[model samples]
Every structure is written in structure tokens, then in C-alpha cells.
Target: MRTRLMEAGLHDGATWRISPTPFLLTSADLSAIQSLGQHLLRFTHALNRLYYESVRGAQPTWVADYLDQGKPPDLIAYARMNRFRTALPGVIRPDLILTEDGFMISELDSVPGGIGLTGCMGQAYTDLGWPIIGGRDGMVAGFARMIRSLHESREGAHSPVASAEQRVPAPLPNPPQPSAARLAIVVSEESKDYRSEMLWLAARLREAGLPAQTVSPDDVIFTEEALFLAGSTPLTALYRFFELFDLKNIPKSELIMYAVKKGHLALTPPMKPWLEEKMAFALVHHPALEPFWTHELGADTFELLHRLMPKTWILDPRPVPPHAVIPGLTVDGHSVSDWKVLASLGQKGRRFVIKPSGFSELAWGSRGVSVGHDLPQTEWAAALEAALASFHQVPRILQEFRKGRHVAVSYHDPVTDEIVPMPGRVRLSPYYFIAGEVGTEGASAGPPSAKSVELAGILATVCPLDKKLIHGMTEAVMAPCTLA
Candidate 1:
């Protein structure tokens, strides 16, 4: 006898977010969130194959010279193309932090944005039957099989399209053909307030006939081949809701970046700003790359992401040899020689967060962060001298915060309308979709091919245990994560 996620509709008329009434999880926390979404999808394919084996010197040439310090060499050689090397990331979210030593993870997005509010709260709690966890249209069939595995990796990476009538009006889990070109989710002008949950996910893929919409980047146009909108129609799979540092205020973003660098536009999370970093979890706690991440992500997915990742650093300001210090921190016991000595401690000796390790607009939502016991010591030493004067351009990372863990939930009060229990502090997230394959072997994420990774919906949030900057949906207690 329960259902208060806005009476089972889960809100957002005009941002009336986070309330609660659907935060269960327990079939062993839903099989450890589907085995932590297949070990964080093999840790993003072993951090994109050990950052291309440190861009081929076979690992550790200062790991692709500190992730190509402030990147740009032709977008790091178009994210090391070997025709987009086993191209991953059709969708995969991971911000997790329930703590008390459980799901810490802290960041890994791949252009994430709550896909149509997790397929409209998993079809409103599985149409009231409620077993929800990637069933009940597994977040719209794992985002329609990751957009039909991006039209099976652009026509003939081993054909998969040419069915379901050149795409969209599918049979069940969307057929998605690019040959006729249609899908579009553009949204730029720096992610225009996530254009109302992508116009309610392009009105549920136009009520299943597909021909989805939700455009922006000035309603895209530039046609010499494709990318149309009010200018025509074309557009065969865009989905990028802008954030490779907002590609210079996107509008004629170089005509959809020279139409996906001349393949005639297909762009997924493929503009790879080093796969959107939080300093790739401080290069997975670099200590001279633990055996190239235990032989490129195995060894039980690098010891289960080195215990759900947390201890990170990457804040290089250079010049400091007064007999070295910073390795895995020491601070008050002496050993930190300048990050303005970790903003001259004090505030409970600052715990640490210090963000921005993405393309920049202060690195996607949560803007240039910098928590450290919630700022003060001269604004945490002016955010550590603007992350050490934008090290050659922009880079920052410090992590080691790990707090979130309160958990209760029952809000509905907008002026005592009733049902309010309030207790907060979650963050969960868990999305993992990935299917854009190239991993050959009769590869499939498209037609009759699936499970390269699935668990499509989780989100959660909660926040408020004396809030330390959680995120959107105001006061927090959001939902859609059931089982218990």
C-alpha cells in the first residue's frame, strides 16, 4: 500500500524533483547492481585499453603524457581511432556513493543525462507491478539497444540495419536503421536545461514509431549531406546532448564537427574528451599503473575497480622538490608541500574533492567543484590557485571525500501537503548501457545481439545529511531504484 513518487508518476512539471517512495534494492542489492554493471563495463574497456597502452609505447609514457596534458591534438587523434577502437559508451553512468564501504565510484559519465528520466521512472514503477530493475522495458529496452548499437557501428562494421523498415517503427526493442537517417537529440547551447527531459524523451520515441526529436544547437542545419532540422530533416543518429566542453557554444559546431569528422554524422559519446575525465579517477590511482591496470582490466576487473575507486590525485602544479611529498598524501603528519599546502588546512583539515578534469565549462555540471570541508580558507586557497593556474590549460583532481550515506525517504510537503519523513544522503546512479561494438566475434548490440552490458536505470540521489553539494532536484530524496 505505497506509491508517492508524485503518486506514482515521478515529477518534473517545472522541476519539482526528488521525493522518494521507491528506493528499495536488496535482492542482494539487486545482484550488486547487476554485478556493478558488469564491473563498470570492464572498467570502460580497461580505461580504453590503458589509454591506448599509454598511446602505444605499450603503457606508461607518463600514461599518454599525463593524459595528453590539456588535450587537443586533433581531439587526441580523434580519440585514437582504429575506426573508433572497439568503440564503447553508448551510455554508462557511474557516480555512485552510498559509502560505509560499498558503492563509492565518484565519477564516470560518458555524456550522461538521465535518459528521459530513466525511461520515465522505468515506466512508472513497471506500470505499478514493481519488480523494476531493467525489466519493464529495461529503461526503454536499454535505450533501444543503445540506439541499435549506433546503427551497428556506422553501416557494415558487420551489417545490422536494413530491417524493421529502414528503422524506428520497430517490432519490439527498436530496430534503429541509419540508412534512412532519423534519430536526433542534439540539445546544445550548453545542454539547454536538459530540454525538459529530452522533451520527455522525444515523446517516448514518438509513441514508438520513432522519428524522435529534441533539438537545439540552434536547431541544427548545415547541410551538404546531412544534419538538418528546421532546415530539412536528414539527421541519422545524433544523441549527443552537448558537453565536450560545449564545443564553443554550439551553433554550427563546425557543421556538426565536419559531420562527425567526415563519416557523415553519427556521433555518440564519441568526441571523447579523454572519455570525459574526473582525471579518469586519477588515472585509477596511479602508482605507476598497477600492472597496466592488472593486465588491461581483468584480475577481477582490476580488483573490482580497486575497491570501487576513491583515492585519487592528479593535481600536478610542478616544481616541488624540498625532498618530495605528495604520494598518496600525508598532510598534518607533514608531506604535502603546496597545493597551497592543501589550502592551508583548518576546516577540519579539509577532506578533499577539487574537481574539473573534463573538457571544461568547468567540467560538466558541478562546475569546477572544490569541496574540501566545504570551502573557506581563502576559498580553499583560491581553489588551489585556480587548480594550479590551469596547468598549461585545465586539469584538476583531488578526491578522497567519500561521505554520502544517510538514506530514509518520504517527502511530499510543498507547504504541508503531507507525507514527509526526510533523512537523505544517497547518490547511486548506476546506468551502464554500452553496445556500440567493434569487438567483432559476430558482434551484436544490434539485431538479435545484446548484453554487452545492460542494467539501464538507477539514478537515486537523496542528499541532505547536512548537504555537501549533491545536485539538482533541489532539497533531494529523488527515486527510481527499487528492490529491497
Candidate 2:
């Protein structure tokens, strides 16, 4: 393709900066252009038909019925005049034009427009100068030829006639561009130290020469004359039959920015009521939440959120749980009823591990005793009893001695704004005893190793709640000893 472009006079002598331009072409170019237009029209029609039929209540047989069902005149006018367009998967406006040398596609403004990078595929194909067969002049002709061949193969059994050219002599005029002044950013307030993060992100946007501001949900002012309030919160739904409402009056082209914390709050129910209403918004959260939002809310909604909140980015550092508590030593099977576990463990041996259920990072205490020796059993039992008596209400778990190396991992869940592994560091001091050497061959000797931190972070993101939550609850039960 590159060789062909060089062979032709396309890239001759003059230093020409490649750019997108509107142009007029000869009759041959127009014919090829018309062919491409027909192909795109068919594609659009098929797309709309599929979309309408796939909609929950829209039956495939009722397509014509719905079209004639007293819709607004503008909608009926489109269906009546552009029958082919109505048959497509979505509302698509195809703009085919003649460039100086060949045919070009001016636009494909579908129902959900402005598809960012994904929409650039056509231009990319053109720039590459993909070879054109069948007497075609340019990339547009190549695209048309490809679609024509596909259609022919599919219609081989049915022997269907090719679609007639429905190309408009001139391309439709471009819609008015949105004003740059209307741009804004929205963010979630649940983030820890959210204000600081917003300021930092806003500063970065300013540095990049983009006008951006971060506003929280509570801070948003939906004045009656400014914008429509269509979505309802949990509390609002009780009083209103439907969660959706229209303000009916607002200036056109006014963009209301939304910066949402992806996983912090349950937004699905509220958003469900406002599915049909369009609004400008974006979501920012840990990378883990990306898949959920993208898969659950369709690409269009995801793109809308990203565009309205460009400053949002995910920081996916490893995380460690905030707290952990391991049940202290117990006297036989007497449990808390006999004595306090911590005191028992402390008395039984000069060193004992304190592990909280459902928590990671074990704490160890050494009371000047050798590894092999044991403390007096009588003292151990008494201490356990005393500790158990002190904290009678809290639930606790007793874990068997786990002699091994320890590490931690961290992660973030965008669905719930809370950072997984709240405290980012895993406790590793006790692991040194199990390994014999304080500094193992592959592990860090000082504070928690980087690997442990990363592990804790990952665990925080993917670990099941039953496991992690139990650890947290255990930690809470042993909070007093954690401080001690």
C-alpha cells in the first residue's frame, strides 16, 4: 500500500503536511463514493434494526408498528423519508463525500456519538492506504468493495438484488461544535483525603492547559433554570413513584459534569431510572473497578463518564488490611471462659503470636525466653483467665500456631469507595522467628517488604469478604492488645 502511494503522484515533491480536509472529486470518484455511501447506509440500517429489535419491549415484527405509532413529527418524518436508515441498528447519519482525489466518509453520527479513539479506525485505514481492487481509486472504494463482496457471498442462496444508490448529492452540514467554556469535572467525595487528591488532579489538568474543576455530588447545585434533575437517590424514590423526573427547562449546550467514585456508592438503581436521560459525567477509582463499570454499564456510558471527568485516573498500589487480631494463648479448651487468651499465651511461653481472626499480619511478643523453653502452666492459665474476664463481650477466634514467613498484599475496589486493605502495610515481624533468620535469603530484613505490600494490595482487591472480613472483625476484637 505504501509502495503504491509512492508510485502514484499522491506523495509527490512538495512538503505536504497530512491533514483531514473536505474536497470535491470527479465523476469516477463520485461513483465510487456513491458505492461506499450505499454500503455504509446498509450497515447503518442493519445496526438500527438490530438495536431496536434487541430492545426489551421492541419486538422484531413491531418495527413498522412502532414507527407509525404517532411519534413526534420529526421522528416520523425521519422514518417516512429515510426508510433504509430506520432499518439499521441505531440512529446513524451517514455523510459520504468526494475528496479532491477520491471518495471520503465525512461522518457517521450514530445515536451514541463521539466514540473517542474507537471512531478513528476509519481514518486510520485511510491513512494506511489499504490497496483498492476492482477499479476503485482510494481507501473509501476499498471499504465499499470489501462490503460488496461480503453482501454478495451472503446473498448467494437468496439471489437478492444489490441496494440502489441513495447518496445525497452533497454532504450534510456539520452540527455546531460544543463550546469549550461548558466543560467541567465531577468527582466522588468518599475517597480518603478526596479534597487533596482532587486538587492534585486539577492542578495536573491545569498544567496540561485543560480547563477543569472537581465538584462533589453534595456540592452540585441543580437550579431549576440551570439544569434538569432526572435521577433520584435512595431516599427520594420512596416519595416519588418513579425515580426519574424532568426539569423541562434548561439552556441548551450546558454541560453538567459528573465525577463519580466508581465503587464507593451503589449508583445502579439511581442510574436505572435515568437511563434514557442524557447527562455529562465521569468516574474515577482504582483500576480494579474498571471492568465492573465497563461491563455493567455499556461502553457508551463509560465513555461519557470518562469524557466529562478526564482528570480521573486509577492509582493501583498494593494495600494492607487496617487491623488484624489472632487469638492469644488458651488454657486447654477452656477458651475465654477460663482466662484471657493474650495473658495465657504471654505466660505459657516467653514468646507467643497474637493473631486476629479474618486478619493478616501476625503480632509477636517475646518476654525474654528461649525458643525451646516453656513457661509455667499455672501462670499461663491464670493470665488467660484474667484477660478473658476483661473483655467478655467481644467475639474472638483461636488459631493454631502457624510457623511460617509472612507477607501482605493490597488492592482497591471501585464499587465500594473504601480502599481494600485499609492500612497498606502488612505486619511481618513474627515471620522472622519461623524462618530462623530475621533476614531471610529472599525477603526484606527491615520493615514490611515491597513484595508483601503488593501481595496485601492484591489480596485486598480480590480476597473474598468472608475471609478478609473475618480478619477485620478479629482485629477489632483484639484492638486493646494491638495498642498494648
* Local accuracy by lDDT, each model: 0.68, 0.24
Q: Which regions of candidate 1 deviate over 4 angstroms? A: 1-86, 94-106, 109-121, 124-138, 147-155, 158-277, 281-340, 348-351, 354-418, 423-458, 467-478, 481-484
Tens digit of lDDT per residue, candidate 2, span 1-484?
2222223322222212121211112346334433333333333223333334424344343323322222233323322222122212111222222223332222232221111111122233234552112111122222112222222222221224433222101121112111121112233332222344344333433333333344444433444323222342211000001111121122221222121111111111111111111110111222433564455445664443333222211111113234522222224443222223334354334233211111011111112112211336565454334323322221112222212212222332333543344222121100000000011111011211100110000001111222221222212110000100
Q: After superposition, how far is residue 238 of candidate 1 from its true place, in Å?
A: 24
Model 1 agreement with the true structure over 1-484: per-residue lDDT tens digits: 2243334233544244445357776676567768777677666767777777777777777766776787768767766666566556677788777766566778888888877776777676677777666665566556656665565446544345445334322333343322343677888766766677787777666655566678787778776776778845676677788876657667777777677666665667676566677777777777777777787666887777877788888888887788876667777677676667677788888888888777777776677787878877898888888887887688788887878767787766656568778777778787877664433211222221334677777868776788786766567666678777
In candidate 1, how many clashes are counted?
A: 4
Once superposed on the true structure, which residue ranges of model 2 sit more than 4 Å away at CA? 1-182, 187-195, 217-484
After best superposition, candidate 2 residue 380: deviation in angstroms?
A: 37
How does model 1 score by TM-score? 0.35
Give model 2's clash tally.
45
Candidate number with greatest TM-score: 1
